[model samples]
Target: MAFAGMLNDEDVRAAVKACQVPGSFDYKLFFTRVGLSARADVQGQRVFNILDRDQSGFIEEEELKLFLQNFSLGA
Candidate 1:
């Protein structure tokens, strides 16, 4: 993954742990934690698509919750 170098495992861990709902994060928090907040809309959509899992056109709560596990099981 080209963006792998931009991710800090520790930061990802922290963000995952910070989810108040125990297993999910809203788009705002997810994007911010993953460093997508400043990207262009097109870039953000690409990231969202990667994480959306079900191809339902949105990152449902459960999908959002499993964001880390989906991409990096160890995270």
Candidate 2:
């Protein structure tokens, strides 16, 4: 897919395999590692505010890019 440039076949396969395994993913730890508090809701405003790098109360293109980069998703 489009992420071929950022991820190899093995990397993609590993992710897919990981998801296929039952209870293998710890979503709370994942979110916490990404600067989010798992104690609150996943789609909470706190998550939005953390992603708003400029604190402009609105997420812009650049801010979104940085946020995606944090997850190694290739801005």
Candidate 3:
């Protein structure tokens, strides 16, 4: 898989418990529960990177998934 699913639902529950009972969020895991990386987080980063096109570090709404239809590796 292209995503690093290191944090699971159990981890989220544990995190919530730790947040309320222990009063601290696992800072290293704040982004995992929300699905936001490619290799270390979720698929969002890879998707965004593909859509970024110009390497501007930002994605515009226009460059959607049109490219995925003809997707191929090593292009």
Candidate 4:
């Protein structure tokens, strides 16, 4: 399946806003809000890219701790 346009900025922002806690992310709520709860592997990769802020091909310790910030700067 095509992966392009799977998630738009508005959807992301809404998901983040709806699912974020004070200092952590609610994965189940966030994925459901983003419609990615049962998505494909490629789609999961897209999420990984978003979380991998440094583009280092991996989610480092700090990145994991600050993953919510990736979806929203003020998160």
Number of the top candidate by lDDT?
Answer: 4
Assess every candidate by TM-score.
Answer: 0.60, 0.41, 0.29, 0.54
Q: What is the C-alpha lDDT of each candidate?
A: 0.66, 0.51, 0.43, 0.70
Instruction: Report the poorest 10 consecutive residues by lDDT, candidate 1.
Output: 1-10
lDDT assessment of candidate 4: 0.70
Model 4: number of backbone collisions:
0
How many angstroms is residue 5 displaced in model 2 relative to the true structure, after the best TM-score fit?
A: 29
Please give the distance, in angstroms, between residue 28's alpha carbon in candidate 3 and its true position after superposition.
22
Runs of candidate 2 exceeding 4 Å displacement? 1-43
Tell how far residue 63 is off in model 2, in angstroms.
0.5
Model 2, 1-75: lDDT tens per residue? 333333344543344344444555454543444334534554556656676768899978687556545444532
lDDT of 4 by residue, 1-44 (tens): 13247765566679777745665566677777777777898888
> How many backbone clashes are present in model 1?
0
Candidate 1 at 53: error in angstroms? 1.7
- Residue ranges of candidate 1 with Cα displaced over 4 Å: 1-7, 20-26, 70-75
- Rank candidates, lDDT, best first: 4, 1, 2, 3
